[model samples]
Target: MPYDGFKDVKQIVKGDLEQYIIYQNEEVELKKFDNFVNLNDVLNEMEIHLKAYNRVASIQFYGITQDPETHSYMMVLEYEQMRIFEKI
Candidate 1:
């Protein structure tokens, strides 16, 4: 599925640069970026999990936003079948 944009980033908290959210099936998946984690690392990790459940279709980075309140960056990831699945 094509990235619909940042329409999924629910909120941005201050002082935390590693936390983000993924909206799926009327639910939210809270995710954290480990210290020094890069975009490629995140994608690889997600790919493994998606493949485990046979839900892998496509994945992409939707966007990145800096929270004015926290000055932290939020990275949004978009997925195809995985997002549509009730469980991931």
Candidate 2:
């Protein structure tokens, strides 16, 4: 389900979600995703997690891939267009 960057993002945030459910750099399948949880929670959490390591002025959410079984996701977030993956 492709979400409109503007309207959909906000809807997802308002939904019941858990940011801690997000995953990174893990060996998992992306072909499938968990329909049970709102991915927005993961996105929100990912952004929060990123801020912990680096100083992020702003984040332009791009894309994501979720592992169906574990219900966790892995994504590459550049350090605010610095072309850096992440500090940690």
Candidate 3:
């Protein structure tokens, strides 16, 4: 992901994502993703990509507050975007 020209880029923040489990009989797969942007536009763009690619299995966002009590702009976004490769 690119964050060039993102003026409000203050302190660096990290993101965390939950696990995604996919199972079929005796087959299973897991996927995870994290969002590392503080801007709303970037995050929205990601949502668009997820929908377009059909990779949006599940999503979650944490730690978004504008109160002065918080010390950091930390947040965590979790998503499941899976890709499959098979022979036609």
Q: Using TM-score as the measure, which candidate wins?
A: 2
Clashing pairs in 2: none
Question: Model 3: residues >4 Å from true position, as ranges?
Answer: 1-38, 55-81, 85-88
- For model 2, residues 1-88, the per-residue Cα lDDT tens digits are 1211112111112222222221242211111223437777666766665575356444444457554447656443332342232222
lDDT of 1 by residue, 28-76 (tens): 3333344424656655655565465454445454444444444333444
TM-score of structure candidate 3: 0.23
In order of listing, the candidates' clash counts read: 1, 0, 0
- Model 3, residue 52: distance off in Å is 0.8
TM-scores, in order shown?
Answer: 0.31, 0.33, 0.23
Give me the candidate number with maximum lDDT: 1
lDDT of 2: 0.37
Reference-based TM-score, model 1: 0.31
Write one digit per residue (lDDT tens) for candidate 3, span 1-88: 1112112322222222222222221112212223333556444655564464444344343323221332222222332222221110
Residue 26 deviation, candidate 2, in Å? 14
Q: lDDT rank, highest first?
A: 1, 2, 3
Which portions of model 2 miss their true places by more than 4 Å?
1-36, 56-63, 77-88
